[model samples]
Target: MITFILRRLATGVAMLVTISITAFVLLNLGATDTARRLVGQTASAEIVARKAAELGLDRPLGERFFEWITAALTGDLGRSWQSGQSVVDAIATRLPVTLSLTIGAVIVSAALAIALGALAAGRRGWTDRVVQVLSVIGGAIPGFLIALILVLVFAISLRWFPATGYVRPEDSLGGWLATIALPVIALSIGAIGSVAQQVRGSMIDALRHDYVRTLRARGLPHHRVVYRHVLRNAAGPALSTLGLQFIVMFGGAVIVEQVFSLPGIGQSAVAATVVGDVPFVMGIVIVTAILVVIVNLAVDLLQGWLNPKVRLS
Candidate 1:
C-alpha cells in the first residue's frame, strides 16, 4: 500500500510538471508584447523596453520558467499583472465559491446516480427503461443550458434559489446552500447521467456473477445482497466515472458561472484571460492542475481500498 501510494504521488508530480510546462509554453507563445500592454499603447518604444526588462520579459523562456517554478514551490505564485494583487491571495479569496459549487455537484451526482443505478439494475422493468431514457436526455443537455433553465425556473420564476452571486458559508449557511443549489444542479446533471449508466452496467454484471447466486442461496435478504455485496463489487467503475466527471465539472463551471453570474474562480479566470493576465492565468492553471491531481489521487486510493486488486496494478 505504501509503495502504491508513493508511486501514485510520483506520477502526480510528473503530471503537474508536464501540465505546467505546457500551459506556460502555450501562454507565452501567443503573448503579444506584455510590456507594451502593461505600459499602455501610448508609451514610447524605450518605455516598453524598460518595462519588459523590469518584468523580466527580456529573459529567456527557460530561465523565466525556472524562476517561476522555483518560487511556486515555496507558495509564491507572483502578482497579477493587471490588478497587482498577489495571485495566491486572489485565488484564495475566490476559491471557496468554485469549490463549493463543484464539490456540491460531485456529492449530489454520486448520491443520485447510485440510487438511480441501483434501482434500475435491481428492478429491471419500467424503472430500468425510465432511468435509461432520463440518462440519455440528461447527458444530451449542455450544462449552460441547464443553468439557464434552472435560473429561469428555480430562481426567476419560483424564487426558490438566488438568481446570481454567492454567499459564503461563513456569512449564512442557508444562504450559501440556496445560492449554490442551482449551479450545482446544472453542473451535476450530465455527470449523473454518465455515472448512473456506468453504475447500472457494473451492478448488472456483478449481479450475474456466481457469488451473487451463492449469496442469494445462503438465504440473505434481497436488499442486503444487492446493496452490500453487489453494490460494493460494482462501485469501482462508478467511482472512476465520478472521478473523471469531477475534472469535467471544472471546465463546465466556467460557462455555468457565466450563466448564473456566480462569483467563482471560473468568472475570475474568464476576466483574466480576456485581459491576458499571464501571471494570474498561470496561477489558475497550476492551482487547477494541483486540484486535478489531488482528486485523481483520492480516487485511486478509494479504488485500491474497494478492490485490493487495483493496488497491484
Candidate 2:
C-alpha cells in the first residue's frame, strides 16, 4: 500500500509539472502586456517600456518561465497587478471561503448520492424510477441557473439566507453557513446527479457478481447482502467516479462563485482574467491543477486499498 501510494504521488507530481507548463505557455500566449495594464492607459510608451523592463517582462520567454516556476515553488505566487497585493496572500485570504464551499457541497452531494443510489439500486422499481428522473433533471440544469433559482426562491422570496457574499465560518458559524447554503446547493446539483448515476450503476453491477450470488445463497439477509457486501464491493468504481466528479465540481465552482458573489479562488481567478492579471491567473491555474492531481492520486490509492487483487497482480 505504501509503495502504491508513493508511486501515485510521484505520478501526481509529474502530472502537476506538465499542467504548470501547459498553463504557463497558454496564459502567456493569450495574455496582454501585464506591465502595460498595471501602469494604466495614461502611461506613455517609454514609461510602459520601462515598467515592463522593471518587471522583467522584457526578458526572454524561457527566463520568464523559469522565474515564475521558481517563485511558485517558493510559495511566492507574485504580486497582483490590480490590487498590488501579493498573489499568495490574496489566495490565502480567500482560500478558506472556497474550501468551505467546496467541502460542504462535496459532503452533501456525496452523502445524498450514496443514499439515493443505494435506495435506487436496492429497490429497483418505483424508487429507482423516481431517482432516475430526478437525476436526469438535475443533470440537465446548469449550475449557474440553479444558483439563480436558489437565490430567487430561498434568498429573495423566502428570505431564508443571504443571496450573495460570504462569511467566515469562524466569525459566525450559523451566519456563514446560512450565507453559503444556496451556493452549496447550487454547486452540488449536477454532482449529485452524476454521482448517483455512477453509484447506482456500480451497485447494480456488484450485485450481479458471483461473490454476491454466493453470499446470497449462503442465507445472508437481504439488507446485509445489499448494504454490506454489495455496496462495499461496488465502492471501488463509485469512488473513482466520485474523484472525477470532484474535479468537475472544482472547475464548476468558478461560475457558481460568480453567481453567488462568493469571495473564493474562483472569483479571484475570474477577476484576474477580466483585468489581465497574468500572475494571479497563472497562480489560480497552478493551484487548481495541483488540487486535481492530488485528488486523482488519492483516488488511485483508494482503489488499490479497496481491491487488493490489483496490487498483487
Could you say which candidate leads in lDDT? 1
Q: Tens digit of lDDT per residue, candidate 1, span 120-178?
A: 99999999999999999999999999999999998999999889988888999999889
**lDDT of candidate 2 over 102-159, digit per residue (tens):** 7788898989999999999999899999999999999899999999999899899999
Q: What are the lDDT figures for the candidates, one per model?
A: 0.91, 0.83
Q: Which residue pairs collide, candidate 1? A: none
Question: Worst ten-residue run, lDDT, model 1?
Answer: 27-36
TM-score, per-candidate, Cα-based? 0.96, 0.94
Off by over 4 Å in 2: 30-32
Model 2: which residue pairs collide?
A: none
